[model samples]
Target: MKKQKIFALILPVIALGGLLTLNALKADPPSKSKPAVAGLTVPTGFDINVIADKLGSARHLVITPQNDIYVHMASTRVSKGIVVLHEEGGKTTIKTSFANYGGTGIAMGGGYLYASDKSGVFRYKLDANNQVTNPENPDRIVTGLVSVDWHQPKAITLDNDGNVYVNIGAPSNICDELDKNRTGCPLLDSAAGIWQFRTDKLNQSYKEGVHYAWGLRNVVGITWNQQLNQLFVMQHGRDNLHQMHPKLFTEKQSAELPAECMFAIKKGDNAGWPYVYYDWQKQKNMLGPEYGGDGVKPADAKYINPVVGFPGHLAPDGLLFYTGNQFPERYKNGAFIAFHGSWNRAPEPQAGYFVVFQPFKNGKPDGKWEVFADGFAGTEELKAQGRAEHRPTGLAQGPDGSLYITDDNKGTIYKVTYKK
Candidate 1:
């Protein structure tokens, strides 16, 4: 009877082992899926390949000197703020949550990657293999940046001296107090402008550096021109062209008013926000209705004028001064700006959903601006129902002298290189 009991127990143990072996054989290893196409159309000489996609609102991108692409992805649910993409043999591996904060800005300067969220800025150190292993805990480079209804994603740029410039957007449209459309009721106060800060230090308050430039309503795109050794920005003009003040501005006047400005910024420069507007139709800067000047005059000499102006509300988001030698000779030392396009320019079709090139000669605009790449706005049908496949928001240059453009609407990055 003891032998019978032993046999029964041995049988159960052998059966159990066999079952476990069968289950192990049934399980399969994880399979790799094919990468999806980005669905972007480019010119004949260029190709739009997706480095990364399906990220949560990938706003801005910057590449390191070693050819690694770092994307700042803003989150609404999961805060995977920054994502680093390493590409090898046409395969991309993504390392996410590189930073604790994420906003609409990412820049590489001083041998480190810097990013800004709604609150503050942070830095990271990349190794020789272009891998960011030690991401420093965030240091508030600048605080008290307005985070109200308007002006949320303050874009950031760095100068050669390691000074960081953050675009602090104004909270209100025209700083209107009563919301009743009165002239000169709201004034240009301390709240509406860009603020500069030092990147080498932490916890620097708004009062540390000078309030770099005033009267800039919302300069979203800021970059330092390495060729010129100067800072440049693309301004988002005031809204509600004729809806806010009808008596002062006609529909045609309102449609073509508020010239989007590109400024070569300097210390103590004021671009005149609430005090004046640039009228493209008149080809002159005019005083703002709030300041009681008619709509057909030149801007005040006390205020600095824009180096170049664009149509109203094109929403320039990405600006880059090309220093690469891969493209044609004319592209060298020039600027490429990506307009995010217009939303309020209704009754008239929306414009500026493409990349534009402005030639520069001797540190200034040498020729008229032209559309460098088109077909971003796929169709012209009003009230059509389809997703805007992409909206260009960031610009970066690859180590091979190719240009990289990123779209926020769909998280796709395109590397553009010249053929032949």
Candidate 2:
């Protein structure tokens, strides 16, 4: 037990060098009865394959025109912040070495590779081969964001117009008196929201960026909707509702209240976090526990409501507005969400380790969201110990219009293709 704890402490650094020596392992054939990709379900005529796996904490990913795939690592889960994978003859293999800072964001914009650790964002210039020119040293793009133990990942995205957006996740569960908010949570000033910066700018601090949106608790799932020319984000809802305010909320209510929300981000939007949360069942923004309100109370009228919402604690981590032509017409301009399941739903059994699709038309929600992909959890019923076989954390589209997903827990990457 002691050894296990210590090993977890230095997992990224210790396993990184050794893991790189591993030969590329082909994707296991999907099994209809198992958690395998074969077991997973997708739309008609769509197929999936695991290109790579056993990577330590692969987070977000980007596929360049050169067919090079760059995956960012979750801090403390992998040795390098960025891991490059190249494919030749249908098999993909990891590059030997790369960026050292741990992070959860990897994006390509303005001819540079952008990555982010817990508190900052950095970038590396790309060469003719679309490879980072200098892996050892990356230029600081945005600095001193925010990083407290919880929800610290600085997942980043870039718009087509060269603006960079960073998610500064709020660090606590509703910022109660017991947590970081004791003396007044200063994190609210620089965290729990989205900030916009110039992609070309270097050495810029948190204060330098424009606070584009607020009240977003933690937005690991963020993407620029190029089709609509807008930003979209999936905000992870707050937890610990019943534990903190047992008198007001039942365990079941806490498990399902405050639905994870998807927002069509417009400039100066405020979704209301820490002080309020969206109730999916109620279809209303309600006051947060810390702000003194019962579970049924309504929140401020000014706060924006999500375009779509899902059950609580599903932990949506990756968001992609599909503009690719490989999929059916129904999916065009629609959004795909990777739900990295969080087991707060306890005795009721955990849920979500799958991807959901939201159909959109004219840049707006046109119908109900539905499960587009499933079987990541590898189990019909969640175990009491609370763990999923694979949790999808990031999503990207390849040049050929194939969808790419990364599993942060196992460092797996899967490509989904559709054909008529």
Cα lDDT of all candidates, in order?
Answer: 0.68, 0.78
lDDT accuracy of residue 112 in candidate 2? 91
Which ten residues in a row are the worst by lDDT in model 2? 1-10
State the number of backbone clashes in model 2. 2
Tens-digit lDDT track of model 2 for 334-370: 8999999877885567888989988899888988898
| Reference-based lDDT, residue 312, model 1 | 88
Model 1 ranges off by over 4 Å = 1-44, 76-79, 178-190, 382-387
Q: Spell out the clash pairs found in candidate 2.
A: 30-38, 31-38
Estimate, for each residue in 166-252, the C-alpha lDDT of model 1 and write its tens digit. Answer: 887777777665345555424344356767788777777666866888888887678999977888999888888588788877776
Estimate the TM-score of every prediction. 0.84, 0.89
